[model samples]
Target chain A: MDFTAILGAWIAVGLTLFILSFLYRDNPLFKIAENLYIGIAIGYIFSITIYNVWIPKIYQPVSNRVFTSLSNWVPWVSKFVTPAGDAGSLTPLFPAIIGISLLTRIFPKISWISRYGFAFIVGYGAGLAIPATVATMFIAQIEGTIQPVFKLASGGAIDLSGPALWTSFSAILLCLGVIVTLFYFFFSLEHGKISKKVTKIGIYFLMVYFGAAFGTTVMGRFALLYGRFFDLYTYRTSGYYHATPILILLVLIFFFVYFGKSRKTSP
Target chain B: MKNGKIAAAVLAAIFFASVSGASAEKKKIEIPPLEGLTARDMPYDMGAAALLEWKIRDCDNQDMTYRIFVSSLAGTGPALRSFTEAGWIKVDEFKGNERLAKDIELPFWAWNASKNIHAVKVSLDNFFGKIQDGSVYYFKVMTLRGKQISESPVVPGAVKGNWFNLSRFNNLFYVILISMAFFWAVTHAKKGNLFIRRITGLDAVEEAIGRATEMGKPVYYLTGRLGMGSMSTIAATFILGEISKRIATYDTQLKVPHTEPVTMTVCQEIVKQAYSEAGRQDAYREDINFYVTDDQFAYTAAVDGMMTREKPAACFYMGYYYAESLLLTEIGSHTGAIQIAGTDAEHQLPFFFITCDYTLIGEELYAAGAYLSKDPVLVGTLRGQDIGKVFAMAVILLGAIGLTLAHVRGWDGLTRVIGNLFNSF
Candidate 1:
């Protein structure tokens, strides 16, 4: 292995051990790792925001389209020109105009101009999302719940018929159950015997659904944990190095956390 | 030079006029018939899904209208039959006034009726027509302008096939993880390790409830409006089940206000069951686990009103919460109630940490249910998660060192090796 390769491997091992020190107890090593993680994550996010959002959406488009247009049309207009002190400087005017409008948001007296920009964005987003939400969420969910269930006959030959009468009946019942249950929670009406009974049945269906949902969630968590463990075992078995140094580092970090906690609590 | 400039200008004007005249003349063009229509696998996310794309011969856009027709390969009619036996049986049917779109997906349910279907047919029609069964049908797309119809080429439908074998791999991984976790938990339990879980939030549950009893005030518990898919809700429900039992023993009043009607109903049942298990079913009140509203801010407003009116001495905010976390917690704080909150939402963790007396972070929320119930299945899963965490730590350290060494020493091979390892799974 090359020197840089070995160094990279060692750093990975050290950082891993540092983070794991928390399992034994939190101490300086764990603290350092935690700080590094936060710092790196923040830095990455900052750079990503600049590259993806600021550059493409704000800087590049404005400079290329608006500034270039101004420069070609009104060259030698010194006052309106961009990059300042240049004769053909209308390039910076576009961003400046936007900046001025945004700055108005900070001033209480001039904040009304900011509403124009906010209105445009909110209106556009709502216009696009409203139809999609109605189609996908409301319509699709209703369709799914209304679909009749089917069962196979004892002969095992594929039955090519529509859902059984009972299945269709149950689908209607479930739909009613959900609706009535929803009505029970409606605050406009006072609690009554019929509403109370409907709500009680709704509770039963809710429990079975929640139980199944809980089971799925447990599966998801276990999957994440399993994936992590798989990585650890695979890496260790790769035999990149003696692994003694990493083991010693972990042990030392654990000792520090244990001793530090003991010292803080001692009478 | 002046003469040459004038000549160029004249030529340019002539060329532009001629080009415009030619484009206007092209408007009377006739459309060609469509042909070679076919449907195949879409490039991406093609599992259980296929794209049916066809080419129309008619070049004019005005004459392009296509109607898609689907029929069972088994030539079975649109009759309802028993799932086991295949015969026409009439059920309910709805007739619509307007014609439906020609190109649409026929979900799995539409197929499997009969194996005799040869092909699907598409046709162009101003009005919807009745579909005949037990016959191979081909679709014809045509353009309609006024009463004129320009027919396109016809194409047949193909049989639907399985998209991919995703279930096989998923099942394999599920079995492995479940077995591993079960074995570890069983082994540990048998060895009597007395697994000491570090859960400061759970430990403080008693203190919070007791304070409410001392104040002679009811304790309020809320499981946020997040649907059943949320892990936080599961943890909250399990914890609530345990807490309900404790409150029953103490004979202290407990109120749980829910946002979703379904969740409210579930909470009521869970609380009732817990109280029954504690042999104090008499103390259980159905109205306590009541539903508010589904509207987010509106629900928050209702909850705030309830909190102010009831003035519960203790509040437990558990499960998935959004922007309302702070609003709820701040109001509870104002009421001088001791609040303990737990959530898996990374964004809301800061609010819980600063406002609540005790907070559970990330995986700790999952551990809460197992810790309280000591359910073998849950405990086994937790132990398995611990093993997974340790494994993750090891990988992170190894990967870091490998990367560092490669960067410093210009080890191209080592870097490649590390990259391959990361991508392998």
Candidate 2:
């Protein structure tokens, strides 16, 4: 292996072990790894915000034109700072102001100013989602469900041909599932005999869905575990020389961290 | 005699040109008049695009090629003849014989105009240069045969954007219907008592907390990454308040580790409010509910480590979770805690199912607090949702039967009628 590949593998193995140690118990090594993970994650997110959010939303638009012929006043600076345009539209300023206002919440004296930011977000979210919710979640979903559950015969009878038979049957099943699921969530209605039967049928569909979901989730987790195991197996490189030291380190951890803890005086 | 014949021929050509100056250039060919030339401005948009459509006059003519030309602010009649340049978008070749050209990449919009006619929809987003709304434009389709040229009448079109789209009238109708149902339910709920079916999952909430109190271990509540403006988080917050109230009476600690600083602040308030309401205000501690790192997996690791070391007797996994669902729950389970998880994250449901003792799935999590609280405002909302479902059932049942009847007995005529009826949204 090259130096970079060898170094990357070593770091990965070391961090994985540091994290995995928590399965046994939380120790100084685990804490160090956890802190490092948080620091790196926060640093990465900050960079992304600058690259994705701040530049596009705030910096470039304002620098291009601060509402007037501000760029023309300083030719040297404007040549470097200004974007190629007559004047940038002032619409971007609203979001920029709101974004800056979110930081004001940290100051107790003027924290109430942040309410405008929160209010804008909440109001915008509600306004945006209501129409979308009605269209997609309510209408479109119903439209999908309400379509013909069975195929009609040429003479106005049901189609029983092999492919058509399965298609029509599954459509009927889907229609049933939708109806029963809706019925199951009907809190205001008392579950009388018919309602009970319908809701019970709903339960069957729900169980099948949950079962399939569980299987998929297991497969996903197993895939991740498999990937980690494969990475560890690559340590067999350089004629098995690295494997011996790694095994010895694990042995030391078991002896000192696990058994040694037990040997301490009773609390 | 030959010069006299040429003079007579020139005189006939001049007479043809004077009748209508259809040609300024060299050759003139008889091009068929294009059919149904129209432009439509898309509704509920920012006045950005215009739809241009024209039927193929004689699509079968093997020797002819068609080219679409557009000019901004090109007027009608004599003024149009004076206009010099007609910027052409594309030229389609007549491939000849029984073979037809394959369906090329079409410019897309919310919906295509129709199937029978040839269509071209243009907007600022797709058109070559500048296309401003409210500006008058002209379109003409030309026919070319060898070196000869023939052109369609100049058709004027202007884009008109609307604030509300009539195409989505059904969507608005649906919204109105639900709104009426909600308002009626709320008004009626205010007047008198109404029946609410019991949600049994909520019963586990109290039991889990009670078990923790008995063991004298703190109850841990992980709200995942559900922040403000999410219904799931709001519901979880309500449930957290209730849990806190119960735990306060028993003098047991409620530990809430939040990933978001904003959520942590809100949770702290909810916890304090619960203690105050329970008449155990002295028992409330601000430090018990605290902010953790906003990092996704890092937050999960912190919670997992805390679960291992502290071994909280009751673990509440609420709001939304992604990959951390299994990790947190598995770690909590290893500590032998009574874990109750409620989330709207569908993909994380299966992981929660295996590890958590009692799981509230999908909409169940949304309805938990409303059901538990029994407040008229919350209950009224649930009632409205139920009413909407009934409306949906009626629509679906009727649509299904209508479609089936249309499909069967080879009555395709029934489909067109019903399709137009149901396709408003």
Candidate 3:
């Protein structure tokens, strides 16, 4: 509503139109917008890492410790120190050292030393991941998959009712899906006549899963598209002095002129 | 008038008797006692926390609520003498039948499997600034029903951390089993007896490269933003090595655009070694492997622009991809390039499947390295992993059957025993 806000909306509308121009064809406007997006994203991530990771984990801790220790030596120095609750531990230095060692890759002579850091990282990650993967992905998955298909009826016989039968059928199908899917990925086993049929069944299950996932993701993409279009429509209001329509009209003209001239220039 | 007076007197007498009978019932009500009350240091964790457990003698009447209180000894010996009721602060309160021991999700080995018992955790550090290991703490459970209250005798507990968690024993057993399997398979593979089934995606990689060679266009390989620590990235690099070697033999230009700088450096060495192995080191260029920005969509956009401009004949997207999977593959699809993608990211597989010519789902990506290299040692690991999967499948089938039988026969104990085998912790 204010001048700066209106100006911001205009800029946003202009960038959005420029980006959307990529759907038409690659042009200077799209390239400019792409480069700006990348540049701004990189800068934003850099500042975020500095504030969130480096300052809190490394800089503040080390500085607080140093200032606290210095303040203990001179009473007047207390005023200069940040109000840290306690003298921070030097434990963060160990990881900080490892992190700095990673930067040694930039130097050719000491690049090999970075291998120690890489080994530490990879070793620690594997050691952590292997157990978790076995537990959550392997054992827990097995536990969740092997549900009881047969339910006891109130008369103490296998349930024959419609709802119970459906439940049992679904459970059996799930179990079958798991078995066949696992068999499909089996490399050591030869896919003979019967094996091929089983694997085919497995492929059907996988296709179903992939199809469901694809449909869901398409819906998500459409939602994103809808959001962008809604923003464009909102900006067309007089509150922003019809910024969307103006920028879109300009982008359309530029696309036509650019494509027409490029076509003429081509041999 | 006489009949009315007699009827009213009888109604008044009946109402008074019913009211007195209700009052008698109220007077006869008694508070249920808390039983089997115990407090101890919680197992499989660092010191400073205690587990309090008790059972209400009669919980069928669900109106009862419980309050748990804890009081910590300030110091050892004489310091403990100063402990008073003021030190006992309420830690938790819950309605009856809530916070049952069975609701606590500890593995069977670590948990006391009493479903009827109430379980509550008390942290000693909540009272003391920093609790010492083996510090003595006392806890009490009080039951409140209507206006009636009954308290359990205070029990002393000592907090001490355990060295090992027995709850994760199953996980450890599986890890060891797979490791042993790997070693045995590797030794056996030395005899050249292992058979790894054909992965059609790896086979397609050759045809894709041939197409690129004939078209005289560069082949692009993009590794997603995961570092060397990721298994998928390592596998991708192995496949890259194999792919690069074949490309060297064909004398086709190959470009690897990396999101992570470390992966780029590693791939450079891998490609160099591959070229040397192919006896085409002279054709290898240092610029083959290059760094791109680590941001996901930005990298995808940059690659999209490049793909549109050059219209590469073949694109290989490997390693762990996120939302960028579809973005890159969709653009490559537009270019009509033969896109082959391999990744362990399950969610991104849908995107790759729809857009790419060849897609490797889940473990197929892990197997791509060994399949392409035909290295017996790596092939042996694949056999070992397959053995593990077969073991898993057998267990799933057997467990399902056993559980189904247990359900039909009403064997709850057997059901639990079988179910616990597959529980993680």
Candidate 4:
């Protein structure tokens, strides 16, 4: 690796160690790394939105159509004139105005103007979401749940083999799970004896689902933790100049000194 | 200029001789016509396409391929036409023995073609000029082997827009039934005739707020990383409005950190209006709702820092969340804060259920607003949703029994019709 790449690896190693120091306690190093993370993320997102969204969608089209059109009388502006396909229309002005109106919330006198933008968003969002939800989530889920239950043999008889019977049992269990889960969340009536029993079974199903999900999530977190530790291990090699071990030593000393003084001063 | 003209004339003569020679070479091999070629309008679609099928039982050559040609001429019956003709367009080409009828997504009730034949859907709108609906279109298939080609007889099919897709009848029925239920419930709710069962999580909101007020620590509320377009965020805002009103009445500090700008803007108005409703507008601070960065982990880190520093007495996590759910809730639990979380994101539920003092699962998150406020409209909507669930359960039960019986009895017709009714087009 080049000198700059090695330096970058060193910095990355130091920062990772600083962040991992939170496992010890919240110290100055952890706070520094946390603030740097937030600051860098804000800068990255702002630049991305400006270049990928605002400049292409708003500034370019408006400047091409409006500014390039003025180049007929002023010749120097012709240098920036775009093709006819892009410069022929002013259709982007309305959304730009609405976008600007959303920023008016900062000004106390005109803050109410932002409501027009929010109202448009909510109204359009609901209009698009309702039919899609019904088609995909509500209707399609019901269709998938109510499946054909039996497998037919080649001669048109019911198959009663072990695998086929297991599939049929699974289908019935799924149907029962769906109905009982729906009962558990039914808000209209109080639960009587039968309803209570059914909902209790539903709660058991929910707990199993939660347990499986928790195991997978914890496994995923461990994999991410392993990735960070492996990086730190690799950086401890001589080519990276022992950046991990040295930085860790310095952090340990700082922690000891910082806590030692505070302990001596306390009652 | 004279020399350039002479070079161009010599090149043209060579190209003409090569074209004639190539045609002669192609005529040396004899390939038979593709048999049983047919074209018909594809069902249950706005008429922009035609489904073409043909038999290919004997070809084993790996290099052989089929080419489809279409024309807008109305009555060009059965005779082979030159593809270089004015209206003909080569729409598609693929290897033989591919694109079987089974590969197509047509419903079983409408399409009963055997799985053995090759099928392709030709979109008429893709031709050079727009092919108008209600006009006749002709299609032909060509089989090619090395330098030789054999053309099938031309077949005609009309294109027309379908008024309705018969496959989505069950969807329409379910929507109409639920809408009528909502209207009926709304009318009855006006007379205070609706009952919503108790949700333990909502009952604890008051106690949590009272604890925060007595301790004189701020109550932190987080609307998760989704925009106003999501139903979960909207429900979260409703619950925020109710919570903020109670906090306003109690004269406790409330801080709402947001990950989406539009949601932050909406929740600002909600909290302001809430405080105004409780006759404590002076107690509401404009900075109660503030924008954090839109980046998920950055927002999580900033909020984690705040939670660690202030150690708020209570934390309310609502709306949709992703991986940051665990990071935020784990810190809240460590701070010894009373945390109540409500979300419809199923994957994130396990984290919240383990960390929070109370958690409202899937639909309960949506119904919490009605349960807390006891508002007629919201309560009516909740009851309507419950009735819709009943409708769904009844269908599931009856459909399961009917499908089982139909399968055991080998009733193919009933199975197809019922299956097609529930299938999405």
Candidate 5:
């Protein structure tokens, strides 16, 4: 392999190992990796948001839309195209002001200015979420819930009831599950014997749902673990030099600890 | 200039000749018409999507691939040529009888009643930028083989940009009805009409802290990686306030490693206020509740390190979480801490349930504070949510019974009518 590719691969393997080292015990290697990742992520976000979001969405559009170049929102492609001269509109300044005010929180004397930004964000977000949540979650869920239990025959008569009996049973069970689950959270009524029975059934659904979710989560976590292990295995199985960084970094960490402890000579 | 124009003409001639194949000079290919061509506005959306559909009549062979073209105005080939220049803007290209993703939003075609077919629908938003809502547009599906092409009859269509989409009216009804229920409950909360069953997960908040005090180690509570504006983080702050007060009374330390500066500031104030209220204001430490980076996984890694090194007696994870939920919870488990977690994030709750001493699933996380303090506003909202649940259960029960009966009785008309009503925009 070429030097750049090999070097990049080695660095990735090193970081992965460092992070995975936490499973053994928390140490300096994991600390360094965690800090590096955080630093890189912070820098990456700042740069990306500046070029991709603020410059295109706010700065360019508002500075003068007539000359605003709205091309290549991604940084990798930087060609520019300006809006037509008739695009002069200052409506974008309102949000720009709110964006700028958020930075004022850094200064204690003028930190109150940040509250305006927060208020705008919270108010606007709450207002937007009302319709969005209503439409996407509430209305959509209800619509999805109301459906035909079985596919009908061409003659429109309940054709072949024997085959479809299980389906009808399952549909009824699903409805019961929904009702009992809803009853599980009801605070108005005390859990008497009947309510307790209903809530118990509801808990069964909740547990089943949680179990399914947990099963999915286990697979997801495994997929991630597999990805990290894949990288370490991919590199080490290839050649001796690829495993050089892994061995050296690990040895160096222990080397410092061993020598430092011996030099202290407290014993 | 003369040479350039000549070269351009030559290029154009070659393009057309190549598109139609060598047979274009002699006998033109007699392309057959497309079957069951139709178009409609995509429902339950923000008027930027239109579903154009057609059957592949000529897909019996491997010679052709289909292409879909769109036009805002019809009978304007010259302008269309200027826009695309090569010909039509090919929105899609598919070989053979490859079917598109099926959409339940569209009504079943009358022609397809006899046979099962791949029902493909395309949304305009995917192909084009926000085209004006309610503006009339045109579509044509073309078939191409060996430079030969067949164009379907142009069909006119428009997406309706609406102030409020009627497709999700049921959801709005639910929201309003639920909100009203909450308002009613809040108004009557003092009257002692609402009866909330005990939540064991919430009750353990005190016990978790007490365990930390006995172990003589710090109690760690990090609201997941979310901004101050998020509802989960806001709720987390509320629960953190209660936890802080309880810990303060015991003179036990509370560590809050916040990701957002603003959230940290709010949390600091909340914890300080809680400590002050508990009459142990002097015991509260400002450094214990400090700012951490906003990078999600990085923050998670930092917390993992803390959990491993410090071995906090109790680790309380509350608020929103993503993949890091597993990392935090796994580390907490290994550290042998009494981990009490609560979150509305359903995906993370399962992991927490399997790992933590006690877990609050979904709405129970939100209800934790109300369950603890019996605050009228919080309790009222919880009660209100229960009423909303009742409405949902009633509707689901009735709908299921009716649909099942109709299916069992073979009443296809009722099925179609009600199904269409529920599914319609």
Candidate 6:
């Protein structure tokens, strides 16, 4: 095996053991591991943001295409421009200008400029999300409720047959229940008695839904635990000699705790 | 001498008889080979799945491992050659890194080479590495022995592709939703404003403790099984510190039974600190907070028993709960005690709504400590969370409008542009 593969395997084993230290009790070793995890995750996020967002969205566009095109068309512009200039260089400068305004928030005197960047981003995001939410969450849910329950026995079209009719009736009832319940939360004024009663019933339905959701959350948690157990068992039985690492780590933890206490007392 | 000789003789005869009896019990019979291999479309869910089942050989061990192989109709040699060649493209090549047993679900993409393929092979590996992939793959499976392969592999039966990739857009939507929530939370956190949070359940905590003190009874608190992720523990810590001061002044009892050892230790420290602050440290008992079992159901059952026996005036169910929520709540209800429950577990909210006097919903649990302590850090984080929610709602709204308008106008380019903008966030 290559060095990378061997090193990766060892790191996985070490992390597993580090996390498992909680089974004994939380200690400095676990704290160290936890801090290390936070540090690595933060580092990864920064790197990815730079690579995926900053570079492609800002630097590369300006330095390559825009500046090159601009300098080629206006050779005299090269004398005034930095080496980073490209074709249509002024096009990329717009985003940089906005970015600089965002950074201005750090300076007390120029903080007002930052509001422009915030307004643009917030406006753009709000404009994109509002319609999608209405279409998917509101419109689609309503449409689903209105779905016809009856089908023709002959497989041609709607049959007003007994089973089909009953199904359609139930569907209508469900749709009505959800709509009235939503109306219950319309807080323009103290709800009328009928609205209050409808809302109370709606609350019951909400509870039932919430209960099911809780069960799902529990199952997800159990799935994570099961995945961890699977990893432990697989490594153990596959002759990976996982026990030695666990044992060594435990000893080291005990020693650290002992030494920490002793130093505290001595000093 | 005669006695010793007789004893030895008897022992030998008993050993001989037992050995013979064991041998006589062993049965030998001819076992049938595997038959009727079939693959059919899996239904009622995603379409990209298929079910594979087989009638096992009579000699198959319950723990026996099965290796399934698929080949094209062209020939076994060609199929094996293709499979070997396409090794790099397989998504789950790493699954073979360790030993696996029993039925395996092979993805449709694994057999990409001839669309119309013939014959599947299955091998039982324990005994003689019985190659059952093709009934005629020049390999036979016997109990524990095999002969050298001297004949060509077999080719059998035609199969069709019955798989498709399921709902790529839906998966993308889910990823976007999660990332948006996380990003919004983080972004708002970076700002120094305290997030506004509504928690009606927390409003009742002081009253509940006061009622217990007035009634001259103890307040019982049980943190759920989740050791660290237990928001209940955090809530319990903050709430208990407040309650402990009242308890010290009123001289009422407070009992906390914890399932996790670490939580038990933390609870002790919190209670002691609270009492010390209240100038009633002498009244504090460390034993009041103690470890139970790590087993989920067992811990709940024990807590139920404690509630019945002690009959505390007030019981707090805070944190994560699973199947035991109903049982605990019902027991607490039966005891005629005031029950206040708070959990983010949406499934258990219904039970709490019916049984408990007050219930904390999702995000409300996180806000409880902040509500009680009014710590700037906690308040700030909560404010951040609210901002995130608002941000998320805005994004959802805008995306919906853009997509709808694009669809209505039959502007595919516009739709792509809008979709890309949504993704960039």
Best by TM-score: 3
Candidate 1 residue-wise lDDT, B165-228, digit = tens: 3323322343465458658766776555445445778888899889888888999998876854
Q: TM-scores, in order shown?
A: 0.40, 0.81, 0.88, 0.83, 0.75, 0.39
Mind giving the per-residue lDDT tens digits that candidate 5 earns over A32-69?
89889888877887899899988777766565553443
Which is the winner by TM-score between candidate 4 and candidate 6?
A: 4
Q: How good is the docking of model 5, by CAPRI class?
A: acceptable
Identify the runs in model 1 with alpha carbons over 4 angstroms from their true place: A1-267, B1-175, B374-377, B397-425
| Interface RMSD per candidate | 24.7, 2.6, 1.8, 1.7, 2.8, 13.4
lDDT of 6 at B125: 33
Cα lDDT of model 6 by residue, A170-226, tens digit: 765665566554543332124568867876887777766777776776677689778
Correct interface contacts retained, every candidate: 0.00, 0.60, 0.71, 0.65, 0.61, 0.06
Error of 4 at A154 (Å): 2.2
Q: For model 4, name the residue pairs that clash.
A: none
- The runs of at least 3 residues in candidate 5 whose Cα sits more than 4 Å from the true structure, single-residue gaps closed, are A66-89, A134-139, A142-163, A237-240, A244-249, A252-267, B1-161, B213-216, B228-231, B248-251, B260-269, B272-289, B408-425
Sort the predicted structures by TM-score, highest score first: 3, 4, 2, 5, 1, 6
What is candidate 4's TM-score against the reference?
0.83
RMSD of each: 25.7, 6.1, 6.7, 8.2, 9.7, 24.7
- Candidate 3: segments with Cα more than 4 A from true spot: A70-83, B1-38, B45-49, B55-61, B70-91, B95-100, B115-117, B122-139, B152-163, B279-286
Lowest summed-lDDT stretch of 10 residues in model 3 chain B?
B74-83
Stretches of candidate 4 above 4 Å error? A67-80, A84-89, B1-65, B69-103, B106-119, B122-140, B144-148, B152-173
Chain A TM-score, structure 2: 0.84
Clashing pairs in 5: A139-B171, A187-B195
Q: Pick the candidate with the highest DockQ.
A: 3
Q: Write the per-residue lDDT of candidate 2 for residues B1-425, one digit (tens) a residue.
A: 99999999999999998765655443363555667777666445657665556665554366766666666646644455543644444423333221121121221223443445655555633563555667676667666777766777877777766676565666666788899999999888887777888766678878888888899998999877867656677678888887888889889888999887666766776888999999999998878788777888988888887888899999999898888888899999999999999997878887888898988877777777777777887788778888988988877777778888777656665655455444534
